[model samples]
Target chain A: MQKHFITLLFTLSLTGLNFANAYEMETTFHGVLDLRATVTDSLTGNYTQGGYGKFALNDGESFTLAQAGGEIALNWDNGLSVHAVANAYKNNGDFKLGLTEGYIKYSGLPNASGYRWQSKLGVFYPKISLENNAYAWASKNTLNSSSLNTWIGEEIRVLGNEITLTRLGRINKDPFDLSLTVSAFVNNDPAGSMLSWHGWTISNRQTLYTEKIQLPYFKARMQGYDLYEQASSSDPFLEVDDRVGGHVRAEIKFHKKGAISAGYYNNNGKPYIVDNGQYAWKTRFTHIDLTWLLPQGIVLTSQLLHGDTLMQSPLKTDVVNNDYTNGYIALSKRIKAHRITSRIERFNVKDNDKTVGDNNTERGKAFTLNYTYRLSKPWFLSTEFTWIDSYRPGRMYTNQPINLTERQLAFAARYFY
Target chain B: MFNKLPIQIKFLFISFFIIFAPSFVANATNTLTVNVVDTNQKPLENMVVYVEPIGHKVTLKNTNTLEIGQANKAFIPYISVMQLGSKVKFNNQDNITHHIYSPVGDNKFSVKIRSGQEVIKNDFNEAGEVSMGCNIHDWMSGYMLIVDTPFFAKSDKNGNTEMVIDKSGQYKVVVWHPQMTDINNRITKTINLNSAMAVTMQLSKPMDEIPSQQNEDDFDFLSDY
Candidate 1:
């Protein structure tokens, strides 16, 4: 059965590739090779291991391959194209090769009123992250992404379809541009489980497609045993409950410099259905973002997010609800080839599920500063320092204090094409 | 060398050259040399220089079609000067589509050209400066200068241009550049081109800032993302 499953996955990827090649293709190849050396100090003297350690980086000092990936984009004259990215690296001490995203998109020419439409299908990430929208989903500002975006990378991928309608304001000589996007996806029932199990953490590591993740020590402490220590990690792209999740996003650009956007995402998963030690999680979130490009190369950005995750017991009588709120404000300035960035972020999670032994209540505040210098056309050097103060009530299970403070200083050298 | 020679010899040489030089040519020819620079005296390339006869009409020499190639997401030869009523063909050499358009000009047009596609041709019946841009690539821009006179040339990298005229007469020297603040104020001076003479034009204001490597339109979620 496992062999059959592997074959099925392989077949689906090939189908996506073949569909892309059916057009008159013109291909562009690009990639980035990034490495970082990091040092961190954590309140808990005992270092975490595996996936959790990689994300938290609350362990011994080490130099590691942060990200190495390549992407090929095939654009056709008929307005059809395909984009795919692959990474080869070590995730949690296990070497793995994975596909980060792949999708086929069809874009239509603008109409008389300067309106355009596009449709995409396959496995891909959402457009909610205004920061991680660059190549390889890399953040353009700091080395470490925000806590909300970090969890997004670790446990969220949409394997379905999305469509967008955009009004080309510039072509019409208008000051504002408007767009609406809607998406329906599956295989994401396990999205919110990791956030509840691990709470919010800060790092730059992206979870590989096939790597099993280890939960924090608090998960075992509160649950009496390791609830997520199975042979395989929860598949974020698995459709256990056979329910389709959907999201809608709307954005407006003002004066070609400022943009305001809002979106709502929900996965209507049935918690009573569990497959392969993975239970369905009914998760939903509302996110809003604002960005302004001020004069003198200054950019100001802000984002607000609120969400809730719920999972029911096997008998369907008891349910656990975890509510989370996250917000951040960031500013960056570009002077020639040098960019300096600073960001302040805060987050809180409230667990209202008294029926379960485990409680996932936590709150944290973070401040980060980064400097990037463009060494050459293909080389970028960056340094970042981050300080985080976190308080988790669940820490008592591991015999540690509830309040924790962590600091990380890291430097990265990247070569991109 | 002339002063060292005998006075009689110098006079004889001057008289012979003046009488025989015009006889050796089909018509009297005079070269109009122009140098264009910014207010700070920096050599400017891509400046269009033309001579308009003050009291007489001069016919344009260029009546054939011209071509501009698009590659590397830019318009090659960013500046072009064409005669009025001359046709131009835009060719796309890159492996992508380019939507070439102009927002304000006497010859306003918008067309999409695909890779390996046939060239799109248009005629410029009106005389004015046409500003060109690619709708898909905001940084891709070009200029076309349409004139009614045949005596015209573009300033080279060293900001120098030489145009040979069939006859020497009273003419106006005009300069136009993409960054020029005022188009009407470009006619610098009027001179009688009786012999080869050099003219220098100083701009009233500094040119626009050089374009940045990072285009503002880049990183838009619709396309780049």
Candidate 2:
């Protein structure tokens, strides 16, 4: 099915290109290349390798091609457009590439009464992260994203349709603008598996559509356990239950100074349903975000998210029940070609069910400081330092310490075109 | 005899009068210089100042088409002033697309311009401020004030702008700025421009902050949010 989807996307893009030339439509292409050198003193392996570490890079020093991404947009004169983004990453000589998002959008002009309507159809990320404003969902302020946004990038993507309504302020002589967005999605029933199994992690690695993330070692995966039939890998974008999910977000923007938004998301999956080794994990969350442009070129941003997830057995028995919360505060200032940013984050997961050998409770705090200098129009140099202290009792099952403190320093060169 | 003179002599005589004619006109006309300042006494720039002759009709000069271009995902010349019934051209000079629109009544228009393309809008038949923005880039804002007369100039960095009126009697002077914290973003003063005049207009309240157009990150290549 994934292969077929890819083929369809390619066909649609090719047809759009042909129409662009024949109809004099607009077509634009953009891309970015990033390279990174990192040094870390983490005692545990990185989470990408199924370890409990809170970073994308593992212990020791390494040079890596962080990401190379390309995006294409075909725009028609009648407020219709098609967009797609593909990304590639190389770490430790291992390479992966896939599409992150592809969608068709329609943005209608404001009417006489100042009302505008817009809609999108396909696969895309929700407008949740205030940090990942750069290309390919990368953080513009820092090399490492906040824990709240990291989880969003890792597990949250919608494969459906969304509609938005906005009332522009300037048209009516008002000082504030208001917008509301609602979406219904599918193929995301297994959304909260990683947050439950691995606890919360802090990284900038966004999962590709066709990728499956490895989970940390747990006794439930062993023979003669309640979850012995569970898959070792979690497919975040799979449709285990044939049910649809929904999200609603509302935002108020005060001119160009800043904006505040609140949203609710629910993937109404049947917890007891399992298909092809993947279980339906019913998940729901509420989130709030604030971005304020303070005086003297300083910007302050914050996000708070709280949610719960549940997975049960065919016998209506509770297998995994967890409640999680994450929040972050960040400040950034730009001085000429240099930008400095600092952020603090807190994350927690509470295990409510007593599933033997599957302890998903964890608590963590993190700090990040980043400095970026613009080398030229298309080039940038950035250095970042990240420190995290986390406690997860689940690590004890693997004969590891329950509490761990990890630190990493990285320098990156990025080019945008 | 003057009409029957040699063509060279007639041309020289006409040239001499044409060269010195501006001094004669300068003596009869009045030069009005308006200076604007904020409450903190800071010189305000980009303020539009114009004078309308009361109880009289004046023929407006034919104005040229004004151009507002998009580059680096920002609108060049954030503010523009044009004569009523004149045309304005929206140009997209960047390697991207921009959807420019204005919601003002009677002057409302929306057009999507691609890279290196231009869209001409001539439906600005009303005299008012037309605020424009790119639907895609919400931070991109611009204003075009359409005045009934051509006797207007935007303030310079020193907060000074000058206009010469051929007939200087009973003129209504007005100052406008988008960020001005005043009713209708305007201040009107009725004065008799019988002689050369210098007017100083100070705002009673502080001006609102002008939003910055520069983005924190140099990610203009990104297609969507």
Best by lDDT: 2
Put down candidate 1 lDDT per residue, A277-387, tens digits, no spaces.
Answer: 777889899999999988876888899999999877677743557999999999999777788999999999899876443668889899999998988867789999988
Compute the lDDT of residue A192 as modeled in candidate 1: 81
Please identify model 1 stretches exceeding 4 Å from their true place.
A1-23, A43-54, A91-93, A218-232, A254-256, B1-214, B217-223
TM-score of 2: 0.86
What DockQ, between 0 and 1, does each candidate earn?
Answer: 0.08, 0.33
Docking class of 1: incorrect
Interface RMSD for model 1 amounts to 5.7
Error of 1 at A48 (Å): 8.8
In the predicted model 2, the residue pairs found to clash are none
lDDT at position B18, candidate 2: 99
Best by TM-score: 2
